[model samples]
Target: MKQSEFIPLTLITGFLGSGKTTIIKNLLQREELSKTAVIINEFGEIGLDHHFIETSDEDLVELSTGCLCCVMRGDLQEAIARLLTKREGGWSFDRIILETTGMADPAPIIQSLVLDKISAPKVILDRVLVTVDSVTGLKSISEFEECSRQVAFADILLLTKTDLVESVEGSLEKELMHINNNAEIFKSDFGIIDLELVLGEYKRQTIAFTENEIDKHSHSHSHSHSDIMSVSLYFKKPIHAVALTLFLELLAEVLGSDLIRLKGFVYIKEAPETPAVVHGVQHIFHPIEWHQSWPYERKETQLVLIGRNISLPWVRAILETIEEEVEETTRQNEN
Candidate 1:
């Protein structure tokens, strides 16, 4: 199916009391997001986040069974499947926003979107927006592993509660950068920020990485804030498509959940003119999206993996070995 035909879904997540609901409530009020369907997954039996959101009943779905990530493979997939079915039945909505519980880990939720046979075909993951409390975000990241993971997996980091705090500490921003340098950070007052900045299509441009930056973060070391880290990889040569598949399969088999998120553009020898967009969570990967053309002048393979206890050198070595073996086999067949 064409990319435009798929519905874009954004994930809104944060630690408890980090203003995730506030951001959703505010976004729903905006005219640009009026036709958006919301799925609010709150912890415990009685859900309250959905009640706070004042959208049409038909557009709102509440999952109060438990944490979203825990039951995401089943309940979350069903919720999205139902929403897609409703849209087919004349429900008017162009996008979907899932607000996960504060305690939820985003990896499984992302996996559901990538792996679910039913919903994966219809919905595309647009972005992951994680709200961080300007006042308590630092503490949350330090204390709660879930909060740190949320920050690590974010595509856009929203620093909420800025209005309440005297001033957001540089330390908090630094800490966030330490966890995920690729995420775009924005300061929000009362959950108000330029919606276009967060929802813009231009933000989908392939991430660029420098050799030095990759070298700096390549080491496997422990951070005081959290063990979660990001590794940027840049490869000049085009990779065989078969080799890419082998690399991903090996990663899922070996790392599993420790591989939180992986996104990048691959330069495939089979389609060297257009870069292949790769996105994955845990063991599941979205079907490769082949762009019409390279977004930038320099066409190469660039990948950023976010997770815990992941070594950059090991990942790089794995890809190099797989591609080398695949190339050798191809040469043998030709000869």
Candidate 2:
């Protein structure tokens, strides 16, 4: 199906008290976003965030199962499916927004969207918007691994509570950039932002880096926070399709939950003209998306793996070995 045919789902996440609910509440009041269906996942027994949103009860579904990143992934999928089913039954909604508990990791929740056969076909991951408290954002990133991961996976970083602070500290912005250079940062006063920026056309950013560059980037940003890190791999040579599958399988088997997020475009030997877009969280991956043509001037494989304790050298070595073996096998078959 065409990308536009799928219902876009935006994920809102942040550290506790970062004002995710405030943002959702404000956005829902907008004329353009009034038709949005919101799914609020709260950690404890009582789910108060949904009540605060003020949306119609039918449009708001609260999940009190557990932390979305841990136990309630299935429930999240089911909720989306239910919402989509309602849409089919004359309930009108163009988009879906899932607000995860502040303490949630977000990776597993993402995995559910990427891997679920049911919801994956109907809904597309529009963007990951993470809210960070301007006053306490730096401390949260330093103290909590969950906060760090939220920042790392974010497509847009919303710095909330800016009015309370005299000035948004440069250190907080610097720390956020250090963790995730790709995310676009914006100052959100009382959770209000231009709707166009939040619900805009999705653009996939390419993260290409050599091993040396990854090492340098890591060393420079090592002092900021948690053990979570990122490694980028750029391969000029087109990899065999079989080799790409093997490479991802090996990574999933080896890294498991430690592999937080992996996304990039691969130049496949079989179809050199079209790039295969890969997105994965831990062991689960979205089906490879084949773009009509390369989105870059240069066509090459550029993959960024974000995780904890992942070795760049090991990942590269595994890919090279798998590619070589696959190439040799193909050559013999031809002979």
Candidate 3:
């Protein structure tokens, strides 16, 4: 087996009191996260969150200097680079996780890694996990842009405090789906979630359209707030690779900031055995990865898009049109 050259870095971000630290505390106790270097940003002089995390001194690094998004960003980079140095000096760590301040927006922090020339090559961003306080989550999204943006950029969203709430289905849930349709929402009682779900490789599970169908997934809803909504598209047939690329390009050009995150596995006609994995943040998309084999016998293309101020009807129409165009061209060439 080929060992991965870069260390995987995960980001934990959410609004104030949204249980970001609570999730980290739970993750530290798991053996899966052991030998993981944790970098935490402290808002004040004392790093209270760090104290709560039970890890060795070598594995824990606290940035009590300043907020990671602002003046302390340089220090954050230095801390990560130092961790790399420690690894060379006989320290053993497989992964790194960073906890951001609740009020902070995650874009800048992500850019810090993407734009860094030196440290960028050493670490690969694995995933971003955002926690939402069920009690105050809706209120925070309504009142604060930071909270909304945090949700927008998340790969996985943990809805904490579900036990305290009378019902999980409400305006808050509707609003969350509107703002970020792409994130997989899981309910957590008190920061207790299976480590596998949190740290495992992302695999999209699709629901069948008909009861008799082998597999499928679907959701439809209307929200009072119109800024964000998740759009899910499932193709019963395999899609052409070029058509899929064009669709993503058009989306990035048109949606821009309105496009929060896009992720899903696609079955391509060109490669029947391997599924093309696609993911993008805003307009910037990461390179596609191809899985060796299908997760199951099902061979269909699936795409889930989370965007702001976009219509599902328009998205669906555009994609259908693109696939049609590709098929027509292929037919003409074959003739």
Candidate 4:
């Protein structure tokens, strides 16, 4: 509606070892997505996924500890909304890839956007990409709710790790149909699929739905809910890098378990031109990535954490530290 067109979100989800990360990495390789912003969410810790991406824009972010559906749901919508508004020269990506935690219920995140009018400012559910590990296929169906949720909500299904098991594209197709008759399932090994096939799948589904159908679909599914929570905190002013870094270290060291993921767009005093953005999953933390320019309507620092048993009060004071409130900071320039 505004200057920015409807933001397209490509939700990538599936069970552990499903090659969801692998396929998304391939999608990043596509020339079409060279400008895409990727949110990579992992469980427990260790963020190796960001290292695998070869892009130079610093467009990749790894979310750890928290699941997107449980805690960062509203934050996700806000982040997208902020992205649409954050621009001195009209910054917009080709797409936004949201990689969910392997052990997650995708519905909460999906429903959050559909139900939350704020996220509807300039964004819509572009498509769902679910990767299934053919080796551990049927067993996951009976064992994990996360597995079923991934398949049931998908618009396009990618069958991965097929090389380990017998070639069962036909059987896998049948299994996918049983759970989600609407999605198109394809076979993949080592995440090797033609970029054409991947993007083409989304384009076809895009063509199938009229604009009115999307409004109806979003309205129809907006009433669902879950127990897990996503939370976002804001500061009147940006904080110094040293204080924020110390705060993050304490978060990972102390409240690591309750925290599934922590992502923030912070304003560091030393670097005033472009703000600092940090993505940390559980114990493993990626050093803050600085943006070349601010991309939204607000200059205030914002932090999003997704998890369980987390008390926003614990670090509320620390996160709210305005750059002016804190002492001088050593310049940590963007790479």
Question: Which candidate wins on lDDT?
Answer: 2
- Give the RMSD in angstroms, all C-alphas superposed, for model 2: 2.6
Residue 223, candidate 3: alpha-carbon lDDT: 32
Model 3 RMSD to the real structure? 4.1
Task: Quote model 4's TM-score.
Answer: 0.55
lDDT of 4 at 10: 79
Regions of candidate 4 where Cα sits further than 4 Å from its true position: 2-4, 85-91, 119-121, 169-171, 196-198, 201-335
Which ranking of candidates, highest lDDT first? 2, 1, 3, 4
The lDDT values for all models are: 0.84, 0.85, 0.77, 0.64
RMSD of each: 2.6, 2.6, 4.1, 17.2
lDDT of 4: 0.64
* Candidate 3 lDDT over residue span 209-261, tens digit each: 23222111123344334455566666667779999999999998898887877
- The estimated TM-scores of all candidates read 0.90, 0.89, 0.80, 0.55
Q: Which digits, one per residue and each the tens of the lDDT, describe model 1 over residues 1-335? A: 78767888999899999998988898888999888999999899988888888988999989998998886558887888888789878998998999999998988888777665666447877888999999999889999999999998888899999999898998788778767767888999978878875468845543534667545543422355777777777788899999999999998889878888888889999999988989877667788889888877888888888887788789889999999999999999999
Which pairs of residues collide in candidate 2? none
